[model samples]
Target: MVKYNCYKPKTEIICSGSSEDVVGQYYQDVGRSDSQGDVDITIGEALQATALTSGEKPVEWSDAAAIHEAEVRATGRKTIMPDGITAAAQSAATRNARTTRDEDKTKLGEVLSNASTKLASDKGATRGDAESVMSVEKRDDPNFTTHPAGVATSIAAAVRLNRRQRPG
Candidate 1:
């Protein structure tokens, strides 16, 4: 077996053991003590035996990199969400709500801008063109206002709910 201790504040150990100690347990677990000592394990045999104990398929050499990465990640005692991550999540949620509200304002602005554009496009375009593009007309007409405003207002309300309106 080989063991290494690598850390400053606390030691971390990694080790590998002989195939006999590893593989014999596999046969005994399966009620096949007869097969125990009879098996002469190569590295391949030992790995297959370990897999049997785990109820897993045999491991491939290709899995080595992923296994190493998992081990490295597990060895560290760091919190999954550090303070920076928590702060970032809070900021992201805040930014998302702000962006959503800005999008609604931009939509509102577009409606007004488009009305101005169509009204000025040609003086003879008629009231219908101005009426179609204008927010006041849309808001005034109960049918036109219902769907979009309901959705936008609900989203705005949800943003308001998510925000820390009372300064803490």
Candidate 2:
């Protein structure tokens, strides 16, 4: 809400706009006033009655108090976001997503590493037998990289190794 002097009859108009085009003198000044007559609407309903037929800053009226109340109502907003960031400082969604992705990748790596170690060190197979089976399975079978497939391949290779070492 503001008071400004207008040109036609030296009357007053109340609105938000530039300080320059104000007809004569105002009780106070805010933004510069140009001949645009276009007032930036802070809200919709407050000025419905005051809207002018035409002119620079047509959204004006003689009543400054009504404009003041309207400004308060129109500009009011709730503070939903956390305080540390201003509107200009807002960031993208990717950083949080990247962090979660990295964590999942680490957990997956640990799971696969544990599975491989367990298969290689299992009771019946020698390390060489386990390594050979794992290598061959990885090369020949599409499912070879899976934990269950590694154990199965290692078991089969150990059985073959055991059979070869026995007396014919």
Question: Which candidate has the top score in TM-score?
Answer: 2
Pairs in clash, predicted candidate 2:
5-23, 18-31, 18-32, 18-33, 19-31, 19-32, 19-33, 20-33, 37-56, 37-57
Q: State the C-alpha lDDT per candidate.
A: 0.26, 0.29
Compose the digit string of candidate 2's lDDT tens values, residues 103-159: 332221121222212211112333443354345435433443523322323344444
- Tens-digit per-residue lDDT, 40-65, candidate 1: 11111222222233222121221222
Backbone clash tally (model 2)? 10
Error of 1 at 81 (Å): 27
Report the poorest 10 consecutive residues by lDDT, candidate 2.
53-62
lDDT of 2 at 7: 26
Predicted structure 2, TM vs. truth = 0.18
